[model samples]
Target: MPNRQAGISFCDGPKEREGREGRPAVNLRTLKYFVAIADAGSLTAAAEAIAIAQPALSRQMHALEEEMGVPLLQRTARGVRLTQAGVTLYEAAQRMLDEAQRVKRQLAGPSEAGESRVVLGVSPTLSRVLVPGLFERCHRTMDQMRLTVREAFTPELLDMLEKGMVDMAIITSMGASADRPLALHPLVGEPFALATPRSMKMDPIISLAALSRIPLLMTTLHRTVVERQLRPMGVHLNIHSEIDSVDAIRELVHDGDWCTLMPVSVFKEARSDAGITLTEVSGVQLNRQLMMATRIEAVPSTAVAALREIVLAELARLNRLRVFNFGKKPVKR
Candidate 1:
C-alpha cells in the first residue's frame, strides 16, 4: 500500500522511497500552493483565490510540512505566518515557479509567429486618459503585440500583478509597497485637485483649512492617501461619503454641492464641461506619483518591453499636450 499522510498518498516503491538519489520528492503543484498561501497570508484566502477547497489545501500543506520535516507555517489568531524555514522555502519556490513559467512560455512559443500578448492594468481614473491613446499607439507601432487592459483599484491591481494576471500595471506611488516583489518605473506625477460644480462659486484655489470644512466625497484609496499625509498636521477632512466608484462620485459631484478630491488627470478631459470646475488646493502637497509596476522575478519578454515603451510614449504625448498640469509648482494662497 502507498504511504499516506494527512489524506495525501505517496508511492512507497523502492525508487519512490529513495526519491531520486535519496532526496525527498518535490511536487511542483504543492510548492505552488505554498507560494499562494504565503502571498495571501492565509490558507482560506489562497484557496478561494485558486478555487480549491480549504480542507484539501490544508491537507496538502500539512503533508508538505511532514515530508520536509520542518515547520513551515505558524497559525495565528489573524491568520498564518511563515516560519523561518517557510520564508526560505517561499523565496526559493517563488523563483522556481517564475522560472517554470518562463520555460513553459518558451516551450509553447508566442501566441503567433513573432507575436506575443501583454496584459496591462490601470485604475479607472487613469484609464480614461491613458487607454484610448495607448490602444491607438499600440495599433500603429506595436503591430506584433497584443494588448489587454484591466481597470481596477490600486490594491486590486497589485493582486492581479502578483497572480500573473497582469504583465504590468500603472499604479500610484501610494500603493506600491517597498516589500512587494515588484519593479517600479516612474511614469509621471499627478496632483490632486478640488472638484466642484461650477455653481458653487468657489475660488480657483482654497487653503487646506477652508478645504477641511467642506463636506467631500472620495474613494477609499484616495481618502487613505489624503489622511495619511494630513492627519498628523491637525487637519481632518469632513468626508460626506466614501464611495469607491469613480462614476458615482463624478455624478454626485456634478449634480450636487458636494466636492471631491482626486488626481487632476481624472477630470482633465472634462475641463470644458459647464457643470463642474476643478480647483487646485493650496497649503498642501497633493502630488501623486504614477509608476509602471512589473513583477521583479519575471523577465520582460520582447512584446512586454515594446508594450511598456508604447505606454511611456503615450504618457509623453499626454504630457506634451498638458493633459494635467503635471510637474507645475503648487498653488499658493
Candidate 2:
C-alpha cells in the first residue's frame, strides 16, 4: 500500500478521500490552513500563526491540493507561492472561512444571547426620547448585546429593515403594517407638545400663522409635528429651519426667539433649562405609537426580551410620573 499520510485523519469526509468525485475532499480545517498559508506566504509561518506543527500543516495542505486535483502552490527557493488557480480558490475559500467563523461565534455566544451582534437602525424622532433610556437599560439588562446603532429618518430606517440589512429597528409610528415582513410591537404613545420659550405667552389652543414671523426649528419629521399640532385651524406654517437635534431646538428656543413643535419627550428634556415649556397641543392632537420592530420570523434572544422588559418597565414608571408636576421651566411650542 502507498505510504498513508499521518495528518490525513484530520479530513472530516470519507469517500475514499475524493473517491469517484475526481476532486479533493475539502473541509473547514483545510480552508483555514489554506488561507493562513496564502496570507503568510509560507507554510512555516502559517503553522506558527495557527499553533500547528509545520510538517503536519504541510501534510494537510498537500492533501487539500490533491483533493483539488490541481497544483496550487508554486514552491520556489524564495518561498511558497500560489498559482492562478490557487489564488481564485483562496479568495472564495476565504469568504467561506469567514462566514463559518461568524456562525461559530454566533453559536458560541449567547444561545439565548442578547449579546448577539446586530446592526440596529434608530429613527431620530424616537432617539430623542428612547436613546438615553435605552442605553441605560441595555447596560443593565442585556450585557451581551453588541449593538451598532445608526440614526436615520423613519422612511430610511424602514427601508433598511425591509432590505433585511438590519437585524431590527425602532421607527416612529407610521401606522400599523404587516405587509413588509415587519412586525410592530407598540411601546409608547408620544403626544405632540409645543416646545417654546417660557417668556412667550401661548394660547391654550392656538392656530397657526399667529406667529407667522417666528422661526420654526424642526427635524425632517416636522410634517407630523405640524399636521398634528397646527393643521386643525387651517394654519399653513412656514418652516424656517429643518434641523436634526431636539437639544438644539430647545437651545434656539431658549437663547434666541424661535419656537418649535415637538414631542412630549423633548418636553421632558427641556424641563431642566427653565426656559422652555412643553405644553399640550390644543389645536390638533396627534400621538405617535413608538414601536419595536423585528423580522416576522425572528426569535428574540433572552437578552433582547429582558432589555425590552426593562424598557417597558421604564416607560411604565414614566407614565406614572406624567401626572405629578415636577415644577421645572416649561417649554411649549
> What number of clashing residue pairs does each candidate have, in the order they appear?
0, 14
lDDT of 1 by residue, 1-333 (tens): 123333323342323233543445656777888999999999899999989999999987886787776789999988899999899989878666765665577578887567787889998889988999999999998888878888988787887788776789999988888788888898888788888888888888899999999999999999999898887788999999999998788878878567999887777664425676778888778878899999886567787788888888999988876766734323345
Model 2 alpha-carbon drift over 4 Å, by segment: 1-115, 118-120, 175-178, 203-205, 208-214, 228-233, 270-273, 323-333
Candidate 2 residue-wise lDDT, 133-237, digit = tens: 667777676667765576777666776666555656777675336667777888767776666777786654454445445567777676555555555666665
Name every residue pair that clashes in candidate 1: none
Give, for candidate 1, the lowest lDDT window spanning 10 residues.
7-16
**Best lDDT among the predictions, by candidate number:** 1
Model 1 stretches with alpha carbons more than 4 Å out? 1-108, 270-272, 297-299, 326-333
Q: Top TM-score: which candidate number?
A: 1
TM-score for candidate 2, residues paired by index: 0.56
